[model samples]
Target chain A: MAEFSLIETIRERCAVARDDVRLGIGDDGAVLAVPIGHELVVSTDTLVAGVHFPLQTAPFDIGWKALAVNLSDLAAMGANPAWATLALTLPSADAPWVEKFADGFAALAREHQLALVGGDTTRGPLSITITVFGFVPAGAAVTRAGAKAGDWICVTGTLGDAAAGLACVLACEDGADELIGRLNRPAPRIAAGLLLREVASAAIDISDGLLADLGHICARSGVGAEVCVDDLPMSEAFGEYADAPTRQRLQLAGGDDYELCFSVQPDRAPALLWDLAQSGCAATRIGQIVVGREIMLTDDSGAQIEMPLRGWEHFA
Target chain B: MAEFSLIETIRERCAVARDDVRLGIGDDGAVLAVPIGHELVVSTDTLVAGVHFPLQTAPFDIGWKALAVNLSDLAAMGANPAWATLALTLPSADAPWVEKFADGFAALAREHQLALVGGDTTRGPLSITITVFGFVPAGAAVTRAGAKAGDWICVTGTLGDAAAGLACVLACEDGADELIGRLNRPAPRIAAGLLLREVASAAIDISDGLLADLGHICARSGVGAEVCVDDLPMSEAFGEYADAPTRQRLQLAGGDDYELCFSVQPDRAPALLWDLAQSGCAATRIGQIVVGREIMLTDDSGAQIEMPLRGWEHFA
Candidate 1:
């Protein structure tokens, strides 16, 4: 098969209907009609073989994670995704492998009603780049720069599960595979993110460990953060893997958890928490923003805790 | 160095201010305000090392050609270039090499007044994937499906220069370095494309040789075409090549031209030529669209020309 045929195969299986998609998947370029009173949110992410995922990972999981990461970016901005373009590179053309990959991608795309609009397929080292385009009402998108000194910090769902999942892959651990599921097929908190846009003062999705990702919000918003270490959200699966030190390390410095971490004013914290609960979203308040530049941690005793702030470094 | 710092380095050097770019190269993903009454145009292209270019080519040229290819796609749609996101993968963190790459990218971006909105950097085999967004007036965009049987086929700029340039590199032909420039640095017909949108009924940018690219237009338009061999525009430098047979092969099957091939009504041909002349763009009428499905070729003597239709096939 030629490059053109491979692209057609992926496109046919991935097509989803949307009225706003003026053109999709076959042309020099795609034409999209942006609705009035909305601004487009676009972000691109690339996932490379071995570097971004385990070499033993299934092809379906790879395709799922590739689009999941870019959608995570859109979710962080409270943008409703509408369309996406993919640039796929492969070492060789494998028909069955590509069909499963397309199936994985289409499954997630259908959930969010995102249409595959344009793409390019080429022969090279295996890698996937996806650019997702979404829209948020004008002046309504949440940004990392909106956090204030007196805001309360909270996180949705649980953390440290994905990183713990990575550990299972590294050690070839079997039996309990929930963490591995979290690592390979992360559920992007799109609903929680869209809800937080109205009540939260600032927002971000955690990808590179809690500390490193939170530090970004502080650096951009010109504020400090104080996290109550004891208040860290942990799943039962993560808790069973290790003792205090290991759990703490995983929660604080482990990465690849695509959960939303956001902030709200103290006065509205009650209302936000109530609304999130009503929406069936489990959220926990774990920290507060301060006027200083420090990102400090504290134990139940109210004393400072010291630890390394490490995340996944692509070029370390 | 880490991915974040490398992104920051490229961001600092490639920044070009535009009012529409609400955020550029920082935060989670860049945000933009699209102009009202316009439709967004998007396209993506990926270039892999040792697959798209020579292994020994300069880093600067690679970056330039990477952005140039996607820009050509947008040009084919007759859209005004706006924002672009880059996904760059590199095997190692080489600071000076990256800087030069960014310099080459920024130079072309500044020329078109395009803003570098968002991107991702990663550690992997070298590849660059660029997704460019542009805008065209609603309902004014020219598509490949608009050609009629009577439309005259036209092309902008000379053919076969870039292919001959590649041959020079393969043979280490030092005396003819101009073709090498054509191979390494292709000039996309942005202005001519924008002009042709008002005059031409169907348009496509020549990337994978004349026959292949034009075949795309014909396939989409449900029509056929015939090229008068003697009418093909050739650069003076290309005339110094081997003999007629070699020249004919290079003209028909050679790829990487990066020019514009389009169809206009026969009645409007003189007007288009007049406009192109005023704009200092060299274009020629090569043939006419037909009612059948074959892409045929004939010489000045009115004899049928027979040659292989082979071009750059990625999977072949």
Candidate 2:
């Protein structure tokens, strides 16, 4: 069967030898040994062609982003990635496309020592569903429910780059290579998450823009947040392409920024930020958790800013 | 957002509170504790609309079969299902459709005590990707690589019912409700698998027909198999609809059975069959593992019976 052969192609490309994987591909299921005293963190995400990404997006980027999004979920939980399963639905058996996709997926899996343990490839419209498995210390997983009202909210890396990249793609504009790269390959903040587990009060991956994802943290923690719109970090490419208003809108409401939005005690914020920067994951404080139920966007003069949209909702 | 509210609907319906799940839905990821001294068994499967099922099939049936197929994988590995993550992609957020789907998913999940841990709902052509997590004792998983030359090859339940059910659906035939039910709702042989772990040398779930799935056990074990065509089990409904040759062809090459095809030592086969019967799963001995690389079928008089096709292959 071509399915078996295609799976063999993926197995060969993603053949990472791990001691914990007792059984890998070509079985009913993958058998994994989770270390004692560790909890398993599992996350699943699906990327649909033309919906999650543009129809003309390269297969390589689709594969990378599919797994990257799921990995970001694990990163938000302060887990070390270990294994993943891919359920790929393709329109046809385009061999070159599959090979490039596997290459992209394998490259990222190799970087984190994550094994492609098992997967299903089927005939259908183009979509990729990736489920990632990682491990964290028992009872030490950073959740979205641990923030206090007085904690400071911080985010890793610059925002709005991916959104700007999407804009470039849509407008068929050229020469925004760095912004495009950000959209194609958003890094999963695994290392920073591991460090944050020790000090952060709560954490979430910023997939649905900074404001929307921070709202998730606030809702789960039963607190509100006051974001200083002027403090949002933006890359040079994003600044060069989008105007001031567009920048604020994109950074605050853009989806697909795979950064970490987390809350930390004000007393430990400076040290934690320094540690994150030393680990190559620079973070900036953008807001404060407050004792209310509504997320407030404040300008430099402490005036409230009215945002049109919160985030991307699938059905809305 | 509506996505969160939709997830809340699913969460309320499929909520099976298990102690091992520290954090479930509404989080970036789910944190789960694997029991001490057990290995995690993971499997993933995706069901694409019109490819995995008829487009007119009920949402409830689609929901049940999606999770059931994945559960069958865990059953093949002799693992007890514990948690599952669902990634559902739909054209729109039809609240009623989602509610029915969740009910069907929750019904089977509750029977096996499986918890829906975390999931993602996205806009796309309809599809459901489920990754199931289960546990088996260390070194005790029944894999397809353990069948010895003298092992007795057996199968649980009858074969070809699902294919016949699909035929009825396609032809718009009536009074084949039982067969159609079999096609829509396959009972994963979880209990029988647990018992087989004690005696079966190797096992695989018959998703891709009896011959193809048993062939997997043969290929993995470096052995061959010989099946007696007359001994293939068939339900009364299957016999009523299919003539002898049709019955033989359908049972041998039809897919989506969700039954277990296992090989056990001849000495232990009788006792294992009895135990499985006591557990309400009947077993039928149809073949024997042999020392070669080819799968052969023989009639009652030992005459070779040729099969036109091996099994269903995606993108074939």
Candidate 3:
């Protein structure tokens, strides 16, 4: 098993036909034709064996999650994913593991119509770095600095499921496969992100917990947010927990939910809601932008609620 | 040191103002405004501590070489270096090590006027993955599939220096500091690559030895090459290695030179050589493309030389 042959295996496995990819793998670099009048969007993410996922996680899950996280970034920008390059490091050249990894990666790639442009494979401790490229209409990208005071804040899909899934995987909780699935393959809200481009003032994907990710929009847009605790969407899997505290912790502060968190102008909230509903994206109105420079969480009675937990912080 | 602060340190340290960079080093991803009528070229490479370099190599050299290898890919395609995103993995976040790594990376980046884009850092075994984005004129990129039978073959800078440097480093050969430098910090023949776009029938960078990389061009272009061993470029660092076998081994089969290998029509050779000379890139006419279906190497008196060494291969 030579390095060149391994790359050929990956190329054969991940092959997808896309006109935009003028050149794919097997070149010094990938040549891409960015369509006229379009702006390119790119992002990279690295996932470690034990730090980002459990060391025992399957190769398929690892490959899927690596691409998923990077796609989440493109989704945040309201960009259509076009291509990806993977820089994979492995402890050894295990044929079955590599084949399964490519299968998982290719399955999701086909689903999103993402072409594998190029990549590198090396011998090292197991880790995967995926750099995804996408395109959006010029000046149409929804960045983090556009939310204004009085904008309505919303989130797509449920929060806390992936966090609870992580807990389940780590504790070996019985019959919590649903939660574990969420952890292994949290879907990026790509459609929802594109829909929001027409109405939302700011957008970001929830990688860190809801509070932390929303706070990013606030900090960047120079506006504060007021989120209602009861409005936080927790999946049914979280109901299995005995106490509300665990659910709240996962919902507010646990990370790895690839859902879209966005803000819309007050005047456009109706249109945003209608469009999302029409597109079958389960979006929930959770909060509003305020003039103050702090993100405040409150109960239904208008009383301020204390922060339930600390956000996930790398290298803290 | 939280991840955010660490990113800020990298952002500040690696900051180089470039007009093409609309935004850099923060947010969900970096934004760039590609010039009109240009295509985007991208490449990714990962360097592991033990697999790609000596485990005890200095942090500065590691950072410089990591970006250097990726730049070589862009050079092969005649693409100008524009922006880069790094996905760095480390076992721990040591501040001193991080700073030195940033310093080394930034120095090379600034030299090429490449901006630091978005990146992700994780705790894991030490490895660095860099994805570089460059731009070339629409439909004007030098590709590996364009060489014809009459094209003259050439290579830039001296070959064998990097490989000789590797040997010295491994054997602790004295007074070979220059060779070690050549191994650790290869200058990508970027200017030469750009100049060859108008004249070269095909171009590639010498990373995995001359024969392997040229084999790429020949394989893609459906051509063969014939080389004169006496005409191969060898650096003065290998003067002590008087044996023809070792010289040929280091000159023809050693990897990591980061020099541009190109093929131009015999009629255009004069112009190509003049252009390279004006750009301060030392290029030599090593051989010519032939009609036969093999890359043949012969001595000055016409006897064929056996391929004495195999190129570096991962997972071999």
Best by DockQ: 1
DockQ of 1: 0.83
Return the lDDT, model 1, position B136.
88
- lDDT by residue (B178-295, candidate 3, tens digit) is 8889899888878888998767899999998988888889999999998888888777767664487787888888998899999999899998899889889979988889885689
Interface root-mean-square deviation (Å) of every model: 1.0, 1.4, 1.1
Return the clash pairs for model 2, or none: none
Q: Write the per-residue lDDT of candidate 3 for residues A11-121, one digit (tens) a residue.
A: 899989999888888789999998878777889999988888999888888888999999999999898899999999988999889998998899889899999999899
Candidate rank order under lDDT: 2, 1, 3
User: Under CAPRI classification, how is model 2 graded?
Assistant: high
Candidate 1 on B20-76: residue-level lDDT in tens? 887677666677888999999999999998888888889888888888898998888
Give the poorly placed runs of model 1, Cα more than 4 Å off.
none
Candidate with the larger DockQ of 1 and 3:
1
Q: Per-residue lDDT of B34-143 in model 2, one digit per residue for the tens?
A: 99999999999999999899999898898899999999999999999999999999988999999999999999999999999998999989999999999999989999
lDDT of each: 0.87, 0.92, 0.87
Local error of candidate 2 at residue B63 (angstroms): 1.0
**Per-candidate interface DockQ score:** 0.83, 0.80, 0.80
Better model by TM-score, 2 or 3?
Answer: 2
Instruction: Output the worst ten-in-a-row residue range by lDDT, candidate 1 chain B.
Output: B22-31
Task: Using TM-score, give the best candidate's number.
Answer: 2
TM-scores, one per candidate: 0.98, 0.99, 0.97
Best by lDDT: 2
